[model samples]
Target: MHLLPSNLIIFPNWLQPEELLYLDLERVIKTIATHPDSNKIILFIDTTSIYEEDADLVVSSVLMNLLLLEDLDVTEEYEISLLGNADRIEWESIVSCIHARIILENENQELLTSFLVKNIPSYKVEDLSNIPLGQLVFNLSKKLFLEERWKEAITQYQKLLEMQSGDADIYWNLSHCYRHLNLLDEYFNTLQQGIKLYPTHERLHFSLIIDFRQNGRIQEAILSADHAAKCFPDDYTFQLLKYLTVPSIYDSQAEISFYRQRYTQGLQNLIQRTSLKTTEEQNSALAGIGRLTNFFLSYQAQNDIDLQRQYGNLVHEIMAVNYPQWCVPLSMSKLQPNNKIRIGYVSHYLHSYSGTLWLTGWLRHSNHESFQIYCYYTGNEPDPITKQFQEYSDAFHHIPDNLPAACEQIIVDKLHILVFPEIGMNPQTMQMAGLRLAPVQCVAWGHPVTTGLPTIDYFLSSELMEPKNAQEHYSEKLIRLPNIGVSYPKPYIPPVIKTRSDFQLPDDAVIYLCCQAPFKYLPQYDFIFAEIAHCVPQAKFLFLRGTLLQPRLKGAFAAIGLNSEDYCVFLSIPERLDYLMINLLSDVYLDTFTWSGGNTTLEAIACNLPIVTCPGEFMRGRHSDSFLKMLGVTDTIAENEAEYIEIAVKLGLDLAWRSTIAERMSQNHDRLFDDKACVVGLEAFYKQVCSKH
Candidate 1:
């Protein structure tokens, strides 16, 4: 090959008979861009071996000739011929552009002749019905799928289905398209069809369960998982899912005890099975185990500090293997204080969730010159508030879905202090939080429970929220900041005034709204509801059915000799505005025991409703009590369960007393709403912690 300039390579030699015929077009393009002389007449023999040096060299020669063609006369004759299997000529443009006249002299090349005739508009300009159907369909559909043109991909797959009936893979692809388009009904139908076509396909069965769960058909989801587990006994993941999908609702003390036993036995078995494995092997096994353990631990009945600590220790062992501590401990080093401290916040809930509501104020008002804030969001969905957090931070990163990639990026960022607001809610973040990725790793009360990981150096909490002896509650050093550590913006009240009839309530009834999720209601607290109902006949408690726990709630009520239907009305999950409206409309806000409402408590205050709180032994149970105390309203903070019922009933019957409490709430609204001193306290704590290092 004679190599020419103009970023083109030309072959000076003819093709050898034994060479491969395929042209690597990608390499040819690279050659054409780097050669020097643009204008050159390149000669090619009839049988030019694309394998001479590389087919890329031939493509470069041809492309260069075309580029220099503009400089020459249009009538300038450049005679070139490629005489290989003509059907193998993938690039028709090269054949058309490099020659003034073309001739095909094959008597029996039917496929090649037909292909050119069908594809070239000037020759035949016809449909390709005679072409092999499967190749064309596969290539087109695959291309469309790769480009993410989901609708067009669906159309291509549909055409494939018409040509080849009962293809399970095609149905799978179509179902995926429906899912991406949010045509959930179609997605389900397609998956069902796929399952019919290929009955034992594990992926399709698993996907059916996922689709059901996504659409909120919890019972069906559980059934599907249960069936899958029974079908595939060796796959512990399906069995784990079966256990997990069972609603965290206990009807009585017996059920609670039974579940606790199962949870403990399950954890011990998982730990033993993965005991002698390598770290990667252990991590793979622990994925399902971690989820099962975390879910059971979250239920109020299984909230044992020792079990939590044990879970943390197991997680720490995995972290020790998977994400080894590579950083020198900051506490051991003496450093100058002139440099700005690099603080990074890691969480999956940096969007319009509870974590954002509590942490946004710190980002908005923190002294940027003193602290460099970096937010690493693991959440896939980003909202307007997520953008706000991005704007306030010095640097923001959306951590990739791949766990190792996210950890690598965090390690590269080299944060001085890494804070995870709530590590328990998401598996990926929880796994990452267990790793020591920074000098100082701290966790906050977004989930409002101790992480119990040895890698977690400190538990950042509010002084008001914790009990008197809170140090014993956490595995890490408990650092209590003043107030809740952030100033909250005023919540929006819905403008359209809703009436009692809008929610199927009687006008004469005294509405005591218990707006917490159903999972927060412990069976132990069910008697309190019965007591309140008995004490105040007009007290109608409102609840939101966020979980599939209504039957359990009613069973608990029945245990206490009360009819749940007469005492309580369960409402569907509402939008933010509707939820606040319900809070505003109610006569009193009854806080849940144990897992108290952190965000709802703030909402109750913003709506100026009288709240009755009974704080518990742990910080998780005392948020509303803390808020009430912060606002200087202690009358409703009951010291015991009896007092909780007494205060709720008093607020129910004594209209004047209710009004007085409401007035006091309204008067101290500013104190409860936007306490900027909280941020100052947080900053001081941050400085103190850094100074120690």
Candidate 2:
């Protein structure tokens, strides 16, 4: 059998089918028995797609077969070219077939050296700088990104950008690198440039909206969303982005007015646009009109259950149009007894934040034998509590921030049950929760409201936390657990204590601690604070400072005829101990109206502080009341706003009554802390729900 002796011979899968046919080869051999008269052999291997299993196997097999060609000339110059990423490949197998591993991507010899040491181990990689400029720079930049060398990646990508400015992916990635390096200006510039180059690019445009929102540039974010919608008028995702951009409520009073104005106008504009002749325009307008955040926030202010359900249906319809392709159901046979039921938990707060405090107990006591826990985290960074959550889970995935990627990963996991600790808090997670990625999906009361998503099967609530007909409040089946559906861990009191003097509080003054975030303080609730302050002459209302500045807070207080000087806004104390100490320093803990505190209330209880709470119609407004009830301290549980003010005044001024309440709290506080029984109820609930599904 005669074989061709070609100097530029490419592998079977490397070249195109046309190129293969043009070669007109007889029988392709892995190795050539080199003639004594053979000249220099330049072997080029296209390992670009070697990350694929088949390609890796083929390349490995071909290289191994080179040893079979014993008569092949060894003296002639043999050059090997590696086309793509070699860091992940088993380079030793291929390296043995060639003299040196030639990296066709990067010019940085040090990068090649480090990669060789870490990946191939003890083998050296040569940076072949003579390769094509665009391919070399693109690979080098990508390699830098994979290695998490952010600054280097930015430089390399920027260099590549000059050569191929039209590449949207490059711009997207380079902007990400700039973000990781905390170069906000560069990040903005890169996205702007990318959008200018590729105006219709959804990914880059979507990123601009996300970047602006994450950085607290709400107006810019809304504008970016508007730009995206205008650029891609028929794109459902951009339309969704526009709808999500301006939240009805905001963290600060300045933003509250700004957002309310924006959303109110935005909604009205959308409604007017809904009358447009184009069905596409009408659909977008209708979806915006029925957006969950705006509707839910509006219902919260007015307690309109009908409006809530109406908006929920609207959102469901919009989601069906936006994400029409539902995930295929997992096989029942996959749920084998010995295999253990795969229960996945998705949350952006798997870290040390107050949101994850109650969840830690369930994770800590998870039955590893009966259930396998998978945690998909979306928070910015993991903390000590995050480590604990990871320790208890069978698998811990730091979910990528991208919506589609996160949702795709959850779908690919084939979870028997997927739970979102809170869906409405994070827009990215909210987007994922709209997809049917599991056999069963549930949302806990971390957000303390219904998700309004059709994909969500259950609202995992606590029996103690909800009203008699709580099912009517939720779109999903309300699965009420025996207690507040989590076992609370005992609050950690750091040994170092803070005093009133440390916070510059007067010893004789009655301190009323309303420690809820600013947004939780509805303008309607400002009257209660003012009334309490007026009733107790020496009262000082201490609130945890949110994104709102003193001026905004002062304006809120001034609206109700209260002097700003009568209250103190405490900046967030990074030390948990300091926070607990501050709670201890207060005479009365006044829970916020409508959206009451959960972890904050528990912390006050643990510190034996008297909390005055006026329960509202919804479960969100009743958490503090529930905890107070659990502890058997209903003296501070008010029936109305007047009673709420009266209780707060009594606690603030009447030292004897306040002391008695504090004593009762001291005795009963243990009842609410670390109830492991709640964990058992939760596990049973999970089992029941999974079994039913």
Candidate 3:
């Protein structure tokens, strides 16, 4: 046989020979040759066996002649053949020739298209009715998913699962689609089904765990995490997930230590398994460890600057390519409503258990005849305090939904100053503040940290809360209220010494009481108290039990060598304020680091109980420090853990000095109760926000 040029020789394997006949190939080849000046002639052939040996020779001869034309046309042909009994022998040889020619010419699409035109429809659907519709539906669903049409994709996958029930992968994909759509309930329901169908699937279990965590079912999340750990024992990601999830459920000093140990072990294992010599690998490891470190630091009572900086650097590195939120100067022209200034307070903590409890006194006593107060409560829980705040306001509105919607309403209200009582603490509240709903948005004591959002115009601070130069670290403008902190109506009278004996502690034992949240016990603060316990052997540490001081949290303290029997006493008082005033039974109050007690510290000072505070670098941390200084009680200031222990012990030991400080603190307490002064400062701030240049 006279062979054509290798480029012009179409391979049999490219054709669907089982379906296409010889006539199809002949017509395709003739069409290409008709155009002599065509740069490329694509000829698609069926299997070599479909044509007789003589016919093959004739086709080869025609292709060779076409290649030799005076114009030297670029002639190409794709000869596709199916592997029947006879064609298998030539399939390998033809495929090798086609690949070689493709490499030489660097062009194959035209030739491939010609082959498809002749034979594709024949074998593409051998019997369309017999095709697996489930698979077809799955493929269609995947296409929709890639297009970001999650709802449409979910519908298609649902149809596929209905047709072929118990497909684990289908259910998994459907769950993923629901998650993308933010249909959390549907996501969990689908995941439940997926886990039921494929109980052994580790990825599905991990997804369930993550969903539980995000939805606030921490205990269920921990259980799911344990399941994932068991299924994927060697997977470092799963192990880390378990370690990270445990802290959210059991947020105690002991749990913190437990998770820290696991984190360190898992981190070591990950480092050893992965080579960190490259920048990418090092960065990934750093990011992972940095997240774990943050979780641990978050549970600590004190802010760790080094730890925070590490986390911030890692976040910046990861998000360097992403855009940041736009912060613009707001125009207050529309903030004031026709000769009246409207102040809006947005918070999720407006209920009974809130800093709003402190605001109740101010609200009850404010000169409401001048400025109008509007409260936007995002929380659903209605309590006496919430009702009181509503009554105090000129106009009160429930947020009805979330922060964004609430902010929209606040903007419509044309509020001159919008105050955020819960800033960094409530995620939704922070999101609302980020929207810049008012011309002047203020942050307050509901959260102790700098909101870190630039939209907040000012921070409601007192000399006791944020000292001089402290405002530099905050993003908001500082508005200093008169006195150290706001005072609420002290309704509960201090219980007598007999009430203290009922808690089983000696009435005479120098009591060192801390009614703050148990989570506030930083490791260093724990050591400080432990040192004090060692110094003042007769002193008993009393921790008033509230929402945070559970048995598990107490166990955490036990793990750190402070036994419940020895130093820790958990007592639940009938009335919080009344019980708080009973701190008088305890000679001295020890303030926790990071979150210094506002109401609790105030109550302590009011009941003539002197509090020793060690202020940290942050605003939330400096409240007690500021309060002590404003009261002219500088001896109560402790610069570090050692000083905290020293002062605590000295106060417990020296009866005369303790009584003198308490008497002095009582006089300072009188200054703190000047609600009129606070009102004056607050009114000025409101006017500033409402006044235009």
Candidate 4:
């Protein structure tokens, strides 16, 4: 076999059929024997030959042989080159192969570190005018991206886009390159162009939604998601996108319920379709189901355990199983004998939100001597809560940049137990958890669902949050905490109730209040409330206004006939603690379905305000149910629209019963306000995880 010169061995335009086959076979065997470093081997198949059946086979054979040589060490000095007639080959097949090879070769050190560095800069746009050369550029660019040479990757993607103008995939790749480079404007513009060009392309629209979200264009993201859902009602991605987008505009509970219903429908449809399909179709359906199942489990959302177990079994049957990725980085058995158990809590919600507010009590009281608390703060905002968390933890690391790297570093530090306080809600936090940052990873109460990712080991739950029978819905093992719920103290002082007269309301009216975010109020909720108002003619609905009372949001509410004084009252309170004052003025608290209240509900209960809650079908929707149960206020739990209205009316009419409940609730506030209990439970959970590790 004659070795071709590295520079002159460009793709040939034409060759005899037998000659090409022979050359391909020779290259395959040589590649096998030499095990040429991926960096040194530049296989250039003339996509022109890809259309010919035998030539296509030859090219595929060459690729297979090269892939087989992956684990073998071949001579590093000589490079392997394959020249194909691009005009004869099937362009799509050739492009797909090129993409696969680029991804695969990225794992080869010699190729990733040296060959990419050496050849990427040398290959210029002008040099790739020919079709085969252009394909080569695309492959190299993909390799650059895989290697994290983002700047060079952008340049390469740009060159390809310029050459293959209006190519949706190329444009999509360019958008990704721009995104990876943090060029937000260009990333979104490029994706929008791609969406315009390929309106039916679900992936492009999905990318647009994600980009819009990452760029902080929440409204645009929702709009894009809505458009996507309308366009592809049956597409799983569209359903997921709709589910994800709702939290930005509506209440978290409502968003969770809506998505969970969609997910269930999607999953059931997938399973039914799989049963009726051919083998190939079944395989595809299984893969789709796997993705959905994983998604549900990844975020600790409501899932069907039997469905997930079936999906997991199918996945295992189809794809070869390997040890979980987290186990690859560290020797778990070796680290068990260590004296100090390093416990790491991974969260993006360590700021002044519900997650931080709820978990801070626990973090503050974690046992520092037995369990070393490592706070991995993944959020961008470093609020007062984050500062408090840092001060409380034994070690605190802020990971606002390079999340995967930070996670990997944490894993390297050999933390015994890693806890994810929130997942699926925050991208960076999920990404970090996906990297497997600890030996024993547990998902706690950041969001009210399971993290479907395989990296997470346990779902930290109470009997109320996840019943043992429902364990199958989650991907992780159920690690139950003691008691009905996790508790947090009211750290800030409750603001004194301001008179309705002070806030410009009628002095004699019975106030019905909803302190939850306005976005959580669905159209159905508006109808329910309207019905409630029709029943209780004396009651004036009051809403605690903050960001939700923005002009546009208020206008939206007004359109639903909830305008100021007519059906609603928006009280703009400057401080969050003032919410207590607002609650005190109201005769009753109306909790929204789908998205129930968290901190606000707790505060309302603490203020002895009767909270009327409608429990939805999913875990997120049932939060208020659990809270009410824990507070021994099951009478406040409404099962449906009719029941909710009935409960409100009953509470409004029976002032004596309301007074008795209020007095009891004010006395029972101590049970829910046990800051000490939260601290103890959290410390125990941490200790247990460390001991197991």
Candidate 5:
């Protein structure tokens, strides 16, 4: 007889129904009842189980993993006797060490971790020698993974793999550790291994699709999504994921239109067909949906507030179905003058990413006495930026990846305002954004798009970025702050001096630096490159190397009768200093049309480069324009495409005008950085929101 585990028991070796299949849980319950204060287990087994497979099941220590599934309150321990033939197994091979636990949730995990350490007083974090190897290592590994201590967990999991080579979970979790460490190659490789080794592992396959989309390999992601949907016919997650797959960079405008149409049709079909019959099915489907985002939808340069609201409503409905209590709007308590209002911020990008560059300033410059700052960082990596977030906040929580556990943690905090730095960029953030965790829920401009979720009460934006009609762009009530909407800290310039030769730039050529990622370059703007290359013989557009979308740009150049090889320069820079060097050396900074630069523009301006921008209809396109307006440098701000090309050309051709613009940028750029007024406005906004609601 083999009990599979918690809640479910399986007797696999029932060769004769009358004997082996006659076992029931009544006798086991009776045994546990009698020894209520002690650990007790009862198993009905005999020599009728003669097969070697049956003996292996009874003998293996891994099967004992079930004891950890439930909350066992007993103070004493129990023993098991393995019945096996002498030739099949030796008596000494039995593992008779103390029983181990598997961590199910954060509370139980802490208890188990403390228990393990108490057992062997001197046991180190990595040491698993004193206890039974498999159970302790697995326990420690899960603990470390949940706590975002990935490297140590990787060590323990790798040890588990050496013992059980065929373990699918080990491969899945190792891949998870690699992902948290930002080891993309290892992450991809391990996912591939898991997919090939255990083709039926649903999470491994879907996770690969997400990885592909994240790394800008959208085509591969689409293929993997299609394959995974076919493989798991019953699971609606894969089916929904197929529709959620949006490309970061489009080869053409028509390609964008095609995908937009496909997504709408696919989403409609998904809505019509999705009818989850059981609680498990509904939970799984919603979890998968929660991990998806409409981040790429904003890049299309169209108004999607209605579409977003529709999708948001669907997500809200699903969330309400899965978590009724969490979806309900929380009641607020009016704060006393002496008491600091508890404010919480949640995001995965509180680490060394573009998100921290803009948002951390708000944290750094906030009035700590009047308002308490609590950060729920969903990301795994611990960087210098993350350390700063911890230092600046009142309570910094490195939240686990599990949605319910993380949500419960935030609920327990009893925050006055729960803020998501951005909603659409991260899946878990999106999941939380759809729920009313606090009395006042607000989303900032980290991703710079409105979350259509009804749960969000406010959208924080910049006065300079949003147009007069920008109120119509969001589902939430818009709250615009002064001067670029961010208390942006000035970027530190490395003191190293370098010549143009260090980067292999042509001495005679006029370098136009387009520092935005390849996705930011719309297909219609490809003609701008060919036009500039045709006009100025010495024009060379500089871009960072190692992206798949570069070839599409090259092809666009080729179609317009220009060999991008001669006119474009793609160089691999070593570090941020080198990127800043490119900004310093470039003749003109060319901002993308529809999706204008944010952090890159700020960095380039800080380096004293003249930014030429043509703001689009949406706020996303006006970031650089806002920065320029804030700096009192308006000469390079173009009103149209012709003006954009003309301004860019003049900046490239006229050295004196370029220098004049650079000098003006250098003089007035101080006003744009570390603006305490922006923080003051934000704090006031928070106070106003609290009082009104």
Candidate 6:
């Protein structure tokens, strides 16, 4: 009956070992009564590992006894510490017996307030702010939402709805939680509920429309945007959302052309709409376009310079009107040779598994004395890579999601140069790229697409990745950095070894791994898989599971007289260790034809997997090809789609040839990784840009 130094405790379970169930309860109660002299009593239910039906009944019985004890000693503090999901507990059934509710992992006061408010007769919670229970819960939910604890935040928001208290903002936050958690069905349902209850809530309506577009429901997305535009004629954002909307996955290349034309027309319409608009009106519309980048357009494998320039100017006009002081080009005095150049990097991807994977080399090996490094991050998550950035930074600012505040802070730093490592991927970065925050503003190939912003002075790209005359493809002055344009660290090979069977893949099959996302696999290139299957009997293509786009590829196979179910394997995307193994086990790495792989291809190379890629028009479409060229292995580089399919089929049939190429890659990987020459070229380029400025 003695309480030990360890806080671990056991509970009764009637379902298992029923003969001792009675004795179990008796001993548990005896221990509690003996331990009660400390004036604190706790019933800890750690269901994270195991849960039984009798847990609630035992907790109830124990609580009932404890409450009776509390009557004898009213000052004894009683609590229930929940180590697992709080939802499984029947709180309503046992609320009367509880003095406090504790969620161990999530130590927040909201649960206590929730407990006190629900059990109104027995307990009371007071606050200096005098906020109501609903407001208190709302505030905590918002805090959790900002911290990206989606599930916990969802639980807090759901409490408001359960208590017959809800609002548009609550629903909006709930919808976002579900969205991040990939509960699309629940996400849509929450948005619908919010929209129906608060029909005129502009943001709620906007969220619904944006959700539709992002989910690949093109018709519904466009229709909702159009409807909202009509409802709020003054809100040009809704109209712009409709105008800029493109398909998440194209049915065919023809669809791409169709959307491209629509996009061009949309730009024209947007131009006229902003021509005479007031500054306030234009600024209000910035959110519509600024809230999203034209992300999907790069997948089409076409030159975006003209359209991008048009859109860039369109955005610039609005920014210029709204913030004329900031929009004006920055004035600068010529820097003396010995003065440390003040350089700034503004991005949302300064973390691992992001575009920073390439930018890290610059941050890691920069000339700290010559360059005063300033990293302004728009993301909150701080992983190992982010820590490296912080360690190297002269000043590190993890800016919240506030565009104006971020801009003002950067301007106050009076940076001589600003670099956006990646643009046209994140909306906030995209919008910020449209403004002239520094005297010499530049962007690198984070997204591998030209930003087209006139405010941008240069486009830093990889000489290896750029096609001949690549400047025609970009709106900014192009500066091609040497080699891969990154002093990329060699990929860390995990020691965990796995086989094909671990992923439920056939051990005997010739697996061609194409691990790109669903939208990246345009239907136009889906036939390439079927054609490879036509020649190689043992060919089995592996893809990441995306239910929505599976049918599109399946239908493409069907058109080619092949049943996709037989030749195609879709497994849920694996953890990082398994992803590396997928590349290692596969006979050939089939690169997505138009938009070539970046990090995945780098990983595949680390595994010595032979990559078959066809270079396309733009830099984004040429990552793997350039990587192969750097490795001195160009046998797998295809000139066209025909050559791409031929090379892929050859790699499948000729194992010896594939092995030779893989061997060559392994030997020359040194040429690809940890090449400090890129930093040298970049520093020289930086000096050149600054001198010109």
Q: Candidate 3, which segments miss by more than 4 Å at Cα? A: 1-330, 334-338, 365-370, 400-405, 485-488, 494-498, 545-564, 572-578
Instruction: Write candidate 6's Cα lDDT for 619-640 as tens digits.
Output: 8888998888888899999999
Q: Which candidate ranks first by lDDT, i.e. highest?
A: 6
Better of 1 and 5 by TM-score: 5
Once fitted onto the true fold, the runs of candidate 5 whose alpha carbons sit more than 4 angstroms away are 1-198, 207-220
lDDT of 5 by residue, 1-693 (tens): 321111111122334442332222222322332443223332222222366575445433233333443344222343333334333133112111112321111111222343332332123212222344455456656766786868766776766666566467878899999998879899989888888888899889978997797687788899999989888877767877777678777878998898888777777777776766679777877877766677787888888887788788878877888888998778888788898888999888888787656778899998988999999888798788889899989999997577787788889989989888778877788887878799999888888877889999998889999999998999999989987888888988765488788889888999999777777877888888877787787898888742555677688778878888898887767588888888888889899998898888999889898999998898889999999999999999999988888898888888899999999999997789988888999999988877887
lDDT of 2 by residue, 572-676 (tens): 666667788888888889888888888898888888789999887888888988888888989899999988888888888789999999899888866887777
Tens-digit lDDT string for candidate 3 (1-693): 221222123334323342242333343344444433222222334333444554456555555554564333324433322223234445433332220111111212443454322222121212222334344456557766776768767866776676568477778889989998868889989988888888777668878886686554667777877777777665534555665453333443575567555545544453345444556654444333322323323544434333333323333332222212213445676533546677788777788764667777667777776677888888898887788889989888887545446756776887777887755455456446555566677877666555545466677877556656766655566777877546555535455645665667776788888787655655434556556766777777787843334444345446555654576676767676547546767888988887677777767777888798989767767777876776678898998878888899999999999999988877765555535667677787678666642
TM-score list, all predictions: 0.68, 0.62, 0.54, 0.55, 0.72, 0.78
TM-score of 3: 0.54
- When 3 and 5 are scored with TM-score, the better candidate is 5
The numbered model that scores best in TM-score is 6
lDDT of 4 at 222: 70
- Candidate 2 ranges beyond 4 A from true positions: 1-299, 302-326, 329-339, 402-413, 546-562, 568-572
User: What lDDT does model 6 reach?
Assistant: 0.75
Cα lDDT for residue 682, model 6?
90
How far out, in Å, is residue 126 in model 6? 11
Candidate 1 per-residue C-alpha lDDT over 1-693 given as tens digits, one digit per residue, 9 for 90 to 100:
222110111222333321222132222322222223112323223334345345446544545654575343212232222344344454342332221111122112233355433332211102221233343455556655766768866776776666567467778878898898878888988888887777667777778876685455656777788777777655545655665443455556675676677656765665565452565565554565444336435655334666667777777776666556542353423345667778899887788898556788778888887888999887778988889889989999987566677777777877778899886777777777777788789998888788777778888888888877888778889988888655777677666588778888888888988877666777777778778888888778888763355565577668767787897887874477677778777899888887787888888887889998888778888889889988888899998889888999899999999999989988998887667887788778778887777
Question: What are the Cα lDDT values of the candidates?
Answer: 0.67, 0.66, 0.60, 0.60, 0.74, 0.75
Error of 1 at 186 (Å): 14
The parts of candidate 4 lying over 4 Å away from their true place are 1-329, 333-338, 518-527, 544-565, 570-574, 614-617, 639-642, 675-693
lDDT score at residue 315, model 1, on the 0-100 scale: 74
